[model samples]
Target: MTAELEARIELAQAVERGASVLSSRVVEAFLNVPRHPFVPAFYRRDGAKYVPTRGHNDAWLRAVYADDVLVTEVGGVHVEDAPDCGVTGVATSSSTAPGLMAEMLDALDVRPADRVWEIGTGTGYNAALLCHLAGAATVTTVDRTARLVDAAQGRLHEVGFAPAVLRADGAGTPPAGGPFDRIIATCAVRRVPTAWLEQCVTGGVIVAPIGNALGGGAVVHLTKLPDGGGGGGGGGDGPIH
Candidate 1:
């Protein structure tokens, strides 16, 4: 690795260490998935270092390893295809930054062999991380964009990791996937979808960013109570910070 690359890695390690809310499995997943593959070529230079003329490669990598959210696509458009050099328009999808992801996972509390579902496949980066923690077969992810879904599928398979990926609306509930142990969304939702609450197992956790735009959003965590079917199950607080 180049000195810059080494520095980048060290930075990621430090962020992971400081992220007390993140779990070890989540940290490992952040370290394991290659953020370079999910990023556009312009943003990539030394594979691990950042190039400002290209994009914030180091910050993106740090976000990935920190389990935070990084916008990769916007307004149903992929970053590579967009004319703008840096992020532009509305962020429709992203490879969630590592720190935020870990925080979500730690809060969701997914365990080994637990069946988990993720909304917003994005670049499939988050799905890959989930597979690393929950096992490939135990994870299922859905995305609204067919192109994004296809691309994410290819990336995951290319890296020798596979999880059930589907093309679907982010707001819609998956088809009887299960009373999932945990459910997460890579995109922000204005409000918790009722369909998602129905699909979750009683007492299961559902995590997602609640609000519009990137800044001033709250990562809400909800627990499905035993009597959740009667509207008694869904209750939680927001802005995980």
Candidate 2:
């Protein structure tokens, strides 16, 4: 088998082992949608500085497939723009750990016809996976910065995904497409965005990391109520866990 294929298989297995839901669809998404194309270059912390690393070589490709979070930006500086000497700053954006992504995606329970709205389209890797789960044309992803939106759009197109990559604050209005079936946030928020809730369908799911703290605490699986309530919904709805 090819090295990239082997690496992706290893990644799929690793993510599968850690994920709470043993979803064959999620595993297939990992194996089919490559992580390297989304992150051509990323930052790896070395001492006090974050070093820029390119994904042109075999080792880098393997690292890309690894279940670790790859920091693609530091203090708004994309890895490709960073100096060779490196720089130290807070990670502004990153491609999340595959295991966590798998867990969250499983919680989202995206189906083929589901209209998904994704918050924080960093590197567009998650968006691509969403496309695999749902459909590319049906997925809409937004990011805070224009740079992220533009870059993510380019990379997504490179890998054959053409989701609606928009430049907007995820906390603000829900973007053009409304009444989304599934709304997911990649970043932690202080509280559920009212606009996000406004846009989601009555029985639709909203999965997000609910925490104001640094790394986030828990992921909440909320279903929109018929009365437009925050917590509970529908007769046969499951509890948010």
Task: Write model 1 residue lDDT over 1-241, tens digit each, in one string.
Answer: 8534564465458647767556666666656656656654332222333222235566544443443445555555666675533444454555544555566777778788889988888777668778878888888888777888898899889877888888888576474568688888777678888888888888788888777765447777788878774232222222221
Clashing pairs in 2: none
lDDT of 2 by residue, 70-189 (tens): 888888788889998788989877787888888778878899979999988888899999999999989999988788889889989998999999998888877777789999888877
**What lDDT does the true structure give each of the candidates?**
0.66, 0.83
Ten-residue stretch with the least lDDT total in model 2: 232-241
Per-model TM-score, in order, reads 0.77, 0.92
The CA-based lDDT of model 1 is what?
Answer: 0.66
Model 1, TM vs. native:
0.77
Candidate 1 clash figure, as a count: 14
Distance from true location, Cα of 179 in model 2, Å: 0.5
